[model samples]
Target: MLTPREFYVVIERDEDGYYVGEVPQLKGCYSQGDTIDELLTNIKEVIELCLEEQEESNKNLSEFVGIQKVSI
Candidate 1:
């Protein structure tokens, strides 16, 4: 069996009120949905597709450190 891997998803609500999700570890890996739950489900599928399309040997996923808020 293959080992399970975890990924960090960055989610944001767009101006149109859709929830958008993106995986920083995988370039161009993203998805959207009407609700948070739906977004999560959709993003999971997208992640799977991205993983399958990438060559395992060449896959270089970045570690998720943390997100910070900046003050102007």
Candidate 2:
């Protein structure tokens, strides 16, 4: 068994002032929006879609197998 991968994500404003989001841990996972709320919603949907795709394909979500972080 393995623990779920969780990492930080930050949304930034692009040249056209559009909200662009990226998941730091999941390479190439990104989304764009016209507003902050939309950006968050879009990113959530994107994450879900990515996870679902991995599940359907029977792929391990994370490429790493070692413990990333652990609580004391």
Candidate 3:
């Protein structure tokens, strides 16, 4: 059995009111849906697809450090 890997996802609501989600670990891995539940489901599918594509290309996933907010 393959060990499950954890990934951090960033979600935000766009101007059109669609919930957009992206996995930072995987480049160009993103998805959108109307609701949070749907967004999560969509993002999961996107992640799976990205993983498969990455495997085909033998791409390496970048390490996620953290996010920060700065006031200027």
- Where does model 2 exceed 4 Å of error? 1-7, 58-72
Error of 3 at 42 (Å): 0.4
Cα lDDT of candidate 2 equals: 0.76
The per-model lDDT (C-alpha) reads: 0.91, 0.76, 0.95
lDDT string, candidate 1, 1-72, tens digits: 999989998999999999999998888999999999999999999999888878765777777788899999
Q: What is the overall TM-score of model 1 with all chains considered together?
A: 0.87
Best by TM-score: 3
Error of 2 at 6 (Å): 5.5
> Which residue pairs of candidate 2 clash?
none
Predicted candidate 2 versus true structure: per-residue lDDT over 3-72, tens digit per residue: 8756455778999999998876565679999999999889988887877776787766444344355789
Runs off by more than 4 Å, candidate 1: none
For every candidate structure, what is the RMSD over all alpha carbons to the true structure, in angstroms?
A: 1.6, 7.9, 0.7
The candidate 3 region of ten consecutive residues with least summed lDDT is 2-11
